[model samples]
Target: MTSEDPHRLEAGHLPTPFSADEIRAATPQGRTQVVRTEPLGGAASTRRVRYVEPDAEGVIQVRTSIGEDGEDQDAPVRERVTWRDLQSHASYPADRTSLERARLEHPLGDLDCVRYTMGDGDAVDTVWFDLARPGLPVLLESRRGSDLVLRVTLLSDEVDPG
Candidate 1:
């Protein structure tokens, strides 16, 4: 899809305890474009931000990632991918009817799932996608303590790339 398409799903969560700047800097240029910052769900240690980028077939996803401090830990490098890849790799519970309903209602398309190790030596998995509009991306974070899920919609228009 062209970059101008406003109806794209782009959302995901970052592992806890990592630097936002580092993650942003490391994100592939143009492929994943940061949109803006968003409020955290609760007492989460990580930060959230929205983004937009083309998937494998060039479909844009309104994406987000949660970042935490990863300086001293063996956290795997933050994993990122196009929505197309995520959609292909997503695995849902066979008996979870509610989850299946949710998927059908708000499909994440390409921005599906990602797994990474947290600083506390635990694995954090995230699933994200567009629910209603391209600007509004949903994020589901599963960590050690509680499962944190957030739905963030695009709040602003495209930032002039000038």
Candidate 2:
């Protein structure tokens, strides 16, 4: 998080918010079961991550709308979230290394907290791990330029016990 404390990548390092187990462990504790994945994408697709979960299958690729203004207003960006079958890390690309940016204050709603970014490009994955919360993606936001197209805030969550 801090410059002094740099991110170290080692074997078996998963850059994702949390592993499948972590998400399952932090499932809703009691009768409350309102927590769930935000309905960003509703249609079925093999290339996009329509919804995300611990055992949900496949890695999610955040889609960014890329185009120039006044180019074509009729063809507005139509994005959807979908998932693919989970592939072994050995087969996964190694380019997804962590690219830590900074440790600064991230204000979600009214509460201001310290958070950091990982991965490269205009929008990196942000997590408030230090904020002391459970489950994967305490807050995972995907943005296109300054406009926030999608945001996953953990309000309440759980996996159906089988």
Candidate 3:
């Protein structure tokens, strides 16, 4: 899907806490993307490529794990999350701790993003949502004190199974 205005998120006003219907409408029915995690401490970096699509039951995720040697390590595993669960996860709490807008650069390219930050002090988590794809997150960052404990990035979503 193409954006009507690529810069809308940077300049225009946006509805905070996107509604479920708005997310459903904005999200593509199917997507195949790579998720990457940065290595922390002595651990190795990891990558997982998964295909997610909608079915009569709800949404299905087919994930294939990649080994540290850069090869598939296991058979694909499938899981389904019901529509009820999707909706519940999509809902925003009545009181949000913090919200902001920013531009993020990812493997998918540059995107205008809306960021939601929760928690305070040493315990904090932040999620950056691509404005073009309302429900999907482009990046998730977790920080402990002054150090970044974990970071997950959505590499790309242009890999179509068809």
TM-score, one value per model: 0.27, 0.34, 0.71
lDDT (tens digit, per residue) of candidate 3 on 36-133: 77746755445554436765545676777677676877888888765444444433332444677899887777889878776666867788888786
Minimum summed lDDT over a 10-residue window in model 3 is located at 6-15
- What is the lDDT, from 0 to 100, of the residue 137 in candidate 1? 34
Candidate 1 ranges with C-alpha deviation above 4 Å? 1-43, 48-80, 88-90, 100-130, 134-162
lDDT tens readout by residue for model 2, 6-92: 121233343433333333344332212222233245421111111223334332222222223312223333332212111111111
Q: Which residue ranges in model 2 land beyond 4 Å of their true spot?
A: 1-116, 130-132, 157-162
Query: lDDT score, residue 140, model 1?
Result: 45
Deviation from native of the Cα of residue 123 in model 3, angstroms: 1.0
The lDDT for every candidate, in the order shown, is 0.33, 0.34, 0.62
TM-score winner:
3
Predictions ranked by lDDT, top down?
3, 2, 1
> What TM-score does candidate 3 get on C-alpha atoms?
0.71
Worst 10 residues of 2 by lDDT: 84-93
Backbone clashes in candidate 2 total: 7
lDDT value, candidate 1, whole model: 0.33
Best lDDT among the predictions, by candidate number:
3
Q: Point out where model 3 deviates above 4 Å.
A: 1-30, 45-49, 68-70, 87-96
Candidate 3 colliding pairs, count: 0
